[model samples]
Target: MNLKILTLDEFSRIDFINLVNKVFEDYTVPIKWDVVSFQLDVKENSISLSDSFVFLKDNIPFGFIVVSIRKEKARIDAMGVIKEERGTGAASYILEHTVNYLKWRGIRKIQLEVVKDDIRAYKFYEKHGFREKRLLYSMILKKTINQEINYRYFPVEPRTAYIQALEIYFNGRKPNWQREPISLLLSDNRYNFTKIVTNSGEGYLVWGKLEKENVPIIDIVAKNNYTDILKASINFLKSQTNCKNILISSVPEDDYLYQPLKKVSFQSILTQSEMEKEIF
Candidate 1:
């Protein structure tokens, strides 16, 4: 089958276009164009392309995987194969090769975040000897105009106080953490972080829209509740004269945000477990 792995830059115009289109159609993900562009940006400068892999048949791309190097670990980000080529052992082969490649590169561990409800993908990871690490408690709090908090931005503003609270939120909330935002901050395409200041406090919303998917995901957000600053922001989004889907993703285990979403009747979506394998 002449199995091979390809990096973003190494991919020809045709192959890149093919993989992205497949991802959208098969995975039901939106905005393949944006992903493709962002892939090039990070793949070219930050991530080492040679570190990624592509499966091929003769010179045709049958399957591909995008691996990322973060800190001392490597993660599998985007992976997909041509529909016709699936079940031809392409997926297993690519994963096996990736493990070996990372081991040879002197790495000991690899991890990736998979979406909840993707049973097949999760099973594949299990078969490959990966173990679930953590689950996030994701929640969505809908915005209601009935409750709005007034706010100002600094000094006397509760919004300023909210940001101040966040400064300490991480310290007390994540005592053992070295940094926050984890791989989500490097670029706009990676995450949509916006600063919202209310009269009583301020916070940030890590949410954005995907090009292919009409839904705008509200990932992880931190806001102050002093005078209902959180509600105001939610109201703002709910009031948005824009077309968007207010969804949360990758909920981790024991998330404080879970309670609020449940109270507001926001449905609880399944959770994804971050899985890892020791390659070294």
Candidate 2:
């Protein structure tokens, strides 16, 4: 089969969005076409249009790869091949082209995340020399409206400088790319940050609005003896907003807050593997 690859700019934004949404129609998370969201992702991850690509057969798009270049590192922000085009060597060809393209651009490392349950993708990356680095999780907490919050806390605006400083003493492993400090800083300013002080130390939580008035906790940090700080922060969030549930994503399994998150009624809803490859 004669295959052609096009730069992301080859198609208009709407056309490109349609192609991606079609290719990922069955993805674990539904992908929607929103210019604002797409632009935010590009800005947050420093994605360059030159590094993004689309694969075509007969001049029709069948696969695509979204890449973000950061100095010596490159990340596969997203990649997909249409369902009908799978098993035809299209994915392999696209991967090869993308890797070579990155290498030519002086990218020494490439990283991506695969849903743990996506056996095919997991094996595909492993077969292509990607090493599974760590487990990242999306956890959720649900509660009744009648429940009461006993702990007192207050909300504050999320500041990049403050988060950068707190990261120095943060005991948890770094989260996946999207939840990292840089991503948070690039995110819209609507997110709410909260702090809790206890005899032991100080803990912080960053949360944002979600559908149905739900609040998704973006990141949390607490000291060893201040695990209860997670509880207080949640209570503070509940008291401030009419959020019905709380969702947290990309939490490392080994993080100090992981166990405490579970104790606060958070349960794992999804899991992904952060994978990386070194290409000199």
Candidate 3:
């Protein structure tokens, strides 16, 4: 069995997309990527093709690890091996190579998230020196918020919202890779920001539509009065889109928005473990 790894930059864009879709076809949540979305992900996540790797067995690509870099920190945005290549040690080999490469590039830390119930994947990361740091919840509000909204929501620039969030809301919190400040800045134009000012305090909502029926709340940061701000945001979103559900993905358990999301009837549909490894 001959196995070799190559950086993603070495592969054609079409080939990389096809290989990723094939490798993740049977993943926990099957992923299908086209050129546009793939390119958008690359841009928004700061995915480093030079550092990302693909593993080929006998010249056929069967495994991949997509890495996103931000300064000295990095995240494994996605990694998978095709079903046919499972148990062939291809995944491990790819990860080992990628980690060594990242360390050599002066990365201080690496992070990734795995489904909480995916014992096999979790064990694989654990075996490779990744430790669970926190639990991230994918919360959803299915039913429309029937309560009347009294507060007015004003549209604000992404930079304005981000600056306020950084100062007050995300100051001491640990947000996941996608919700990091840099990620928000990278994808700023893709989302709309709304600010709600109340007697108690002010809050901002960062939201956008990924699909017709699904509205993703990318980030909701507030100085005080989370419930009112969240309710107003939901009501505004409901008025704007034909979305069937409002979702907030990968919310850390310790996040200020977590409890408020539950208070506003957002149920946890999925849970993931945020894992990390410190590179020396």
Candidate 4:
């Protein structure tokens, strides 16, 4: 079979979406891919179609890998091969080519996150020079508004500088490439920030709705007494938005906010392994 590779821009948006969905058809996690989510991801993470690869066999897309390049770092946003194309070396071929492409572009590091339970993918990345770095938890809080829960927080429209300041302490709380301050600031979507003050001092929460899931994704940075702050923030969300759930994704090992989040009824729904490779 003849193998060829092309970038995302080479295909129409609809075709690209279809190919990705097909490739991920039987994925471990059910991903509902669509145009809006795709556009948002690209916009928020500075993903250029030129750096994202689509592999074809005899002119039919059979595999693909998406890379988001920053100044000196690149992130593997997603990678997959069509079921029939698996075991035919298409994945290895695409990965080898993509790594070389990034290195030639002067990228100093590459990173990605894989589901913790996906042993096949973990082994694949390990075999391919990626080293496991940290454990991350995906936490979810299902909406169960208590009649007694109080909402006394005010919303604050965040400036980049303010967000950065809040992140100084919890900056690495989330995954580096996808959920960090850099990515959040670049997001075209608006964020909702809430500030609450208690006897212990002041605390704040940063959150917004997931465009596709329509659930809130939250990040908290606050004083030592953060439990009350978290509760108030959730109450505010229930009061203002129709969000029925909240997602706190990819919280890293030793994330200070994890325990506080748990105290506020956030439960761990999934786990992930953060992997990275240093490129010369």
lDDT of 1 by residue, 1-280 (tens): 4655566567775656567576558573332655567565453224556787666688877777767775567777667778887787878888888888888888778877666578888898899999888765444433333444654322133233235445655655431111134333344344445556766556555545544322344433454442354455455555543423356655545454555555545565556667889865
Those runs of model 2 whose alpha carbons end farther than 4 Å from true positions after fitting are 144-157, 160-166, 169-173, 222-226
- For all predicted structures, in order, the TM-scores are 0.73, 0.87, 0.94, 0.86
**Model 4 steric clash pairs:** none
Q: Residue 85 in model 3: shift from native, Å?
A: 1.1
Worst 10 residues of 3 by lDDT: 143-152
- Provide the clash count, candidate 3: 0
Per-residue lDDT tens digits for candidate 3, residues 1-280, read: 7877788899778998998888777777667889888877888799999988887778888888899999999999989888887897878888998899899999999999999999999999999999999999998999666545577778888788778767763468677788766676777578888887655667888998748688988888787778878888787788888677999899999887889899989999999999999999
Q: Which stretches of candidate 1 lie above 4 Å from their native place?
A: 1-3, 28-31, 34-37, 40-48, 136-145, 153-185, 188-194, 197-201, 209-227, 239-245
Best by TM-score: 3
Lowest lDDT 10-mer window, candidate 2?
Answer: 144-153
lDDT of candidates 1 onward, in order = 0.58, 0.76, 0.85, 0.76
- Candidate 1 accuracy as TM-score: 0.73
C-alpha root-mean-square deviation, each candidate: 5.3, 2.8, 1.7, 2.9
Q: Give one clash count per candidate, in the order shown.
A: 27, 0, 0, 0
lDDT of 1: 0.58
Candidate achieving higher TM-score, 3 or 4 = 3
Evaluate model 2: give its TM-score. Answer: 0.87
Query: Which is the better candidate, 1 or 3, if ranked by TM-score?
Result: 3
Give the best candidate by lDDT: 3
- List model 4 lDDT by residue over 1-280, tens digit each: 7878888888778888898887777887655579988888888778879999888889888888889988998889889888887887878888889999999999999998999899988998899999998888888888646434444666665554256444664644444565555665666455666676555556667777655434665566664666776777666666667677778788876666778887778889899998999989
lDDT of 2 by residue, 1-280 (tens): 6778788777677778888788777888666756777887788777777789988788878888999877898899888889888898888988999999889989999999889999988999999999999898888888724333345456665664247435744644465666566666666564666676655566677777657877887776554543567766666667777677888887877666688887767889999998999999
Worst 10 residues of 4 by lDDT: 160-169
